[model samples]
Target: MNAPAGISTLDRVKIFSEITIKTFDILVIGGGIMGAGIALDAASRGLRVLLVEKQDFAAGTSSRSTKLIHGGLRYLKNFELGLVRTVARERKVLNRNAPHLVMPEPMLIPILKNASYGYWATKAGLTLYDLLGNVETPERHRMLDKTQTLAQEPLLNPEKLQGAGCFVEYRTDDGRLTMEVLKTAHTFGATCLNYCELRHFTYNEEKRITGAALQDKLTGKNYQIKATCVINATGPWSAKIMQQDQPEKLPELVHTKGVHLVVPFEKFPLKQAVYFDIPGGRMLFAIPRQGVTYFGTTDTPFTGNLEKPRVEKEDVAYLLAEVNKMFTGLDLKPGDVISSWAGVRVLLYEAGKKPSEISRKDEIFISASGLITVAGGKLTGYRKLAEQVVNKALEKYFPENRQPSGTAKIKLSGGDFENAAAVKGFLKSCQEIGQLHKYPSESLAYLVRNYGTNTKAVLKEACRLKAENLDPETRLLQAEICYTIQNEGVTSLSDFLIRRTGKLYFERGQIIAILPAVKAAFQKILTLGNGILANQESEFMEQFEAAVAFKNESKNAMVSA
Candidate 1:
């Protein structure tokens, strides 16, 4: 029952050689949140699992989410009671298991004179929401008067503000959560590889999938892996994988593009997260995090590159117009936007339904070739989706020794606290470490929150490199870079900046200042060549440009005019 040597990040070449010769009980494709969840569920149940991602983990839709682990209160408007209850209950499970990664945030829903729901109706809806989800907050839902609402969020448009409803929602770093899940799975003997692409599926004589042909993107070397079962948890790329099994079949999933914009808190400062009204019966969220106020998510159907979805000028203009209308005098422009992200939702294709109108419920599809595919679920419902997918795989392939999912009772990696209170105490202890090292309190707190119990390891690395005489900030950055490369399988610079650390999105302003230190850390620790370091730097820059592509597009358009 010994777990396979921890994650294989430090020596990937050795692990790659080993996995090619060893067979697994399950081979999971696409190491996003869903694949990570499936690997955790299966491995914890004593099943041998191998998970592969074409890019770095959480480099897709999983990283580019609105980043809320809520019960989907908005689903109540559509009367999707069951969906609300499932995700709400899962919300509590996530909070219980990963308190640092899934901290609670107070959400304010402003009631406008021309609002979709009146104050009373909003109250009743939340009442049902609480009853269904078993919401347990210090103070559940409260109805605030117009004066109280404005006092809480003075930036709201007060001309026609009726009131507001304050409730609890859990905020998360989606990419970090995915990494923690995969790491926990690795602890249970799951072999995971990022930057490993699946070329095609291998089949037995019965035409059932036996395994897959995979290629390491970094080494450009190919390997074949054998497994009894193969699950397509590829999220947006589910359709593409399914086509390999049945080329004549139509795509069962549709890609819906969601875009988010980040700006300095000084530009659009708010005390708490606000889910407010926009035109056309829709709404949006503006949440504050790490000195930035970020908001988004236009629900338009996407028909572009799946690997690289870009935020468009129209998408930014739409969000800006809506948010500006709701918050008086903000007058935020493209220049105010420091960074932005775009992700595609791989949803179940329902005829004649708009992207916004489609249900977020996940469905399992088993093709004639025994390829099991899961499509269309929310970020909060990932564990449940994984449980469902695992159960079906067990029921079909390994019926003799089926095991129930124990993920709910287990903590994710870096979330080994006794309880929520203990997590807070741990954060306090992390700040003491910062004080000892003369590190900024804010930076230390950020590390503790994102890395959870693993912050000690980061600090240990920082201590080891103290003789380098680097600035405290740069030293800390190098320590994080080292930690992620050795442990989190950070194969490239963008992976560290975007997913592992979240500096690219939340702390965009500091990226340029820290780039040199980041490159130095990677080079010193991994002995990367100058050419490799340059390529990684160029890739990171491309990611940064993608975040501001919309603004650049407008500038290009103006020049053409």
Candidate 2:
């Protein structure tokens, strides 16, 4: 089948018009990782699918993850062997399919004298972890003595460091992964819309759900979309959507907030990804990427705004304290943080469990109104969650032509390479294009890593705009902006900066420097007026500042006094 048309503003308007006029086989609410996976799965099965997101794809928990595609080795501590195995197997599948995006990174688990897990206990756990997850012998756990561990990553605290566990874990760009899945779903003929809000559900005489009332956040125009099946994969907002259907039902989600802080490599200089425990036995990661080290994830109960979860001063203090304790040589402080992000996890409401203790296992709820809702899943398990959700939908609504999920065998968008070697060869070839276009080797390699097989398309666009006489960096940025606006449904600058490319997290300086050029390019291509451009810029800056800000007025005043 032919690939679907690129997702521009015009394409979005076209899709809105089409979905408004016809009934679809499935209407998927929320365009995060899980929803994107569901859309792809259903569409690959020959079902007409429509997916809508209130914001840009992966603008929530999906984008704000710890960015690991690992087997959830930590879950084994709680005796969740099944989840560990499932995520480990899925990690292999993701690495096989999206080699350019999913990469194997060596993780170091420091064994301190006062560490929660002793040397032998940690080894036993890791051994069981490897066995249950079917880890290859070569890629399995390795016991690193204190000298070897410190040699690998010299920043570790050596005062009481007994040894470490070195193992392989898959790292990924979560937002880009979600986008590729959504794009692949579109390729398979699923119509998807970002920046589209769901107003309410439409029900038939028996009160069974039949359709959705959606409003385009950009155009402020409303449209009604009819569908035979509607799946609610709204992540943290699943409770809100379910409440709209059954107001009497108690809320089923416990919102746990996780935050990450990014520090330049010069300050921390972590050579490998380290998963170390804090004072309270909770684990956090400090992974190095693009000349920076980022670590996170405090699991506190969140009662704040879901749309804009800001990193608080306490959150930063907690992370910095943990990092300093583990890496004693690094005297890191809140001031060292250049950027940060907070995300809310919509975990199942298990009575009497702490926030971190809640299970990451996904659960699906089918309301009496025929509204199918899925909640409480990790990013690593999105495909299986989607497969399960679609299977149930098919059994209930389309039993006559039931089909199993094809996603496992098929590669995601831009992930058609046969193996990791093929990906390396492709990247090596891309360097020639970079040389021809005067693009830096590093920038081109970054694009290849992020876009995979689609790197050529972006390069072609960059070549087409070579006459613009842009700087090497600006040219690369322009090419990405052009590709995103023309093909990736980037309705706003924040979408392009934060989700499409992770400039907000990794390339903050570049984003600020090229903001004007990017804005002009979007305006010229999408015909966005000055007012819209200004609003988008303001919103992007506000979000950028909120993510990085660490000082609270009240706290600062008390400290000073």
By lDDT, who's the top model here?
1
Total backbone clashes of model 2?
0
Error of 2 at 528 (Å): 1.5
* Model 1 poorest 10 in a row by lDDT: 1-10
Please give the CA lDDT of all the candidate structures.
0.88, 0.87
After superposing candidate 1 on the true structure, give the runs of residues whose Cα lies further than 4 Å from its correct spot.
Answer: 1-8, 137-139
User: Candidate 1, after superposition: displacement of residue 542 in Å?
Assistant: 1.2
Taking all chains together, the TM-score of candidate 1 against the true structure is: 0.97
Clashes of each: 0, 0
Clashing pairs in 1: none
Model 2 has an lDDT value of: 0.87
Candidate 2: residue 246 lDDT (0-100): 87
Error of 1 at 432 (Å): 2.0
What TM-score against the true fold does each predicted structure earn?
Answer: 0.97, 0.97
Q: Alpha carbon lDDT of residue 435, candidate 2?
A: 81
